[model samples]
Target: MPHEGEATPRISKVQDRGWAWVVLVATVLVQALTLGFPSCVGVFFKDLQYDFRASNSETSWFPSIMTAVLHAGGCESILVERFGCRVTVMLGGLLSGVGMVASAFSKSISQLYITAGFITGLGSCFSFQAGVTVLGYYFIRRRALANALASTGVSIGLTLWPLISQYLLDEMGWRNTFLIFGGVMLNCCVCGAVMRPVPDKPPGPTLKSCPEQSREGACLSNGSTSCHEEPLHPSKRAACFQTLQKYLAFDIFCKNKGYQIYTIGVSWMVIGFVLPLIYLVPYATLNGVEEHKAALLISIIGFINIFMRPMAGLLSGLSIFTGRRIYLFSMAAMLSGLSNLICAISSEYSVLVFYCIVYSVSMSVIGALIFQVLMDVVEMDRFSSALGLFTILESITILIGPPLAGLLVDLLGHYRYVFYASSFFMISAALFMGLSFCTMEAKNKLKETNKPPPETPSKGKYTEVPTELDHDRNGPPTVVYVTSI
Candidate 1:
């Protein structure tokens, strides 16, 4: 319980202009250079296939490991907590740059997995996640818009990278193209340099008080934050969740049900989410499309999303959709599954173009909202840990997803089945998430409806009726107050 004279605490953030805008730009570019690279990886498919003499499943492992570790930044939260975003971001850039440079010189598929998959993904995790952490803190009034704009970097990266990779692959082949890519990846250092620290003092949003968090599933809301403003001395604290929270932050799973649901659902969703992007170019090539033209099919998706992402973000931020973020996301996920069925139907340029545009719109919404939704689930400032943990859970499926898709390709000897598999995963994930959230809401409402009314207190003190043991000894009604447990 709080002392009578203490004030409520605010989580500081929101410069909303000037340096905040610069940081936002940096966040976008960091995402572009790191997260966006994977989508264009398909451009190197044929060359890598020819050089390595690998089957589809073997080839698929490279990108699978790259993307899996990209989401598997288990240590990112600790880095951000101890070192701050700027240093973490810069360090990531350096690691990724080195990884790419090493990948250029690699002689085996296994070596590329180490250099490109693990190391580069590690570095990207650092730069991308840290930049986003700062971005979340910097805006409240325009969070949706800022996130939308920030996410366009992925679209932009996707749009430009495949085209650039194609041109480079033609001129210099995959190895030298990777050498240039290493240099390009070093640009993350510049973006990281822009991730200024979030302030600890507020002109920011106040933490809602304990009284409002009466719902059964509410996370971390039952607390007197101001009462515990001073830290507990180490000797006074027991070795428990507090100790775990200080180090691993895994205690958050126990605290936040939304985080649990979102993380698990998205993990399943990712099993199919990236398959379409990975196989799209190959599918087109096999269907009599020119190699360059097939690459353009990917480029078209990126281009449409460049426009679609911000619009989705803007539409979501409107008054009518203010509380509808999850519903919107679920709808988009379903759209992603349904749209892939179009590619299964035909690979003609026009049909593929139509598919790309639809996929782009769906992809745009998912990308724009992905992190935005995470930030909403966890408490502010603790985003780094929440996200770090999320990536760890998410990375498991990411690692297996593409290779699983490739195995399907190998077994069936047809690319269309990959889309069919993708459709099932995406659509099922959407239903699970949409229904789960709706069910949680209904349960909360029922709990609220049936809750007993609070008894009025007498003479400005909270009163609890004495139990059997206390009845004989008590002179007056017992006083109790809510505690930050």
Candidate 2:
């Protein structure tokens, strides 16, 4: 006597439970490792320049090309769907590990580009996206908390990598650092292995288990009279191609207003997002701050971001603020934009640090909620497509942002223009989001006011009798229908 819609025993046995924390740890670890290496690119830039006899632009290819592949290699979502989490991440880990090791042996600038840029970047794309997809599948009620926790890996990586790179540079130099870091990334394979795919639901019973011929009175299977019965019609299965055609959609973005605004805002935000962080060191040095102080600013930014991400998640999950993340994201961006403007005017180290604090919090809010905000706006079923499309869009921005900032610096011979330009872009993105959500809210209110009240369903039987109704109640509207049992 199984309850309707209750998972069958066999199916339930395969469904993993209480392993979500394990999944979270693995996701966090891989993300921390993957992001840690890339964020420390500046440390190796000068060393690379001397070794390869490359120009600033030539050296820039190492990070720019790597980031381009990281963003533009939008294969993670598709692979996640096809190969599942465990394999996709494991493969990514292997590629990334091998790429770093190969980097240690490079002789030319082209070698670094091919190894670090295309090879390592592809690896990161797989590992990063697989980790995110795993989090989404394993947790729903605490999804934001999980995302916040995992995203701390980025800050932690940023914090840790610089110190590690500095130590390695002081001891064994750049080549050996790649050797050391490459060895470190091998742990990602272990992380990937732990991210086992959730098992599928067991198939329904065969004809022999169907009670259709066993008990005539109980076999009223096609009717609603009995709770134990199931519908007797054959359960049709769509062809694989047909199923794919139905589920895979690109036009969903155009149809969804929330997604359109979110995508555009996120794209713009990303276009200038990493620019300030990229210049923090150079900006400080230009104003006569010591190299050590410039490096510590990055550490401070990471320290604050590590704490902010989880806190924002917890706040977003609160009962009072359910389904309103767009508002929070908008405010954070505005504050961050203001901080960038402040940094532009300041020559004092203290004022610069103040701006870093503000920037850290805002950046964390943007990173922590960007994907989650998408999930809230787009239905869960369509998240795969949305993220896939989003990766393609954001990749272009990631490829452009830092270099654009550097270009501004090169053109103006000062850091001020770069900060002002980036701040303007960020502020513009924030305003777009604010107006978009406000418009959405207004539309909802308008629809509520104009729509006719639903007709109440009939009870057993009744003559019409109108009762006094209070339309001013704050709860959902009520419509009363007369009936007699």
CA lDDT of every candidate: 0.72, 0.67
lDDT of 2 by residue, 1-485 (tens): 34323433422332224777888889888878876556677666657878998665566667766776776534665565456778888888889889999999999989998887788888977887677667655554455456667777878887877667766876898889998877888788899898765532222355343444333322211111111334455334545443443344356566767777888898888766766766666677668986567667777887887888777766766767566778888888888888888989986899999988888888777776676576667654555556667667777777777667656665666878777888888899999988977887776656657986337411211111222233222111121110000
Clashing pairs in 2: 461-484
Score residue 48 of candidate 1 by CA lDDT. 82
Question: Per-residue alpha-carbon lDDT of model 1 for 420-460, expressed as tens digits?
Answer: 99999999999998888778767655665798644642211
Alpha-carbon RMSD of each model: 11.7, 11.6
Best by TM-score: 1
Model 1 stretches astray by more than 4 angstroms: 1-14, 136-145, 194-258, 375-385, 447-485
- TM-score for candidate 2: 0.77
Q: What is the lDDT of residue 46 in candidate 1?
A: 65
Provide the lDDT at 246 for model 1: 49
Q: In terms of TM-score, how similar is model 1 to the real structure?
A: 0.78
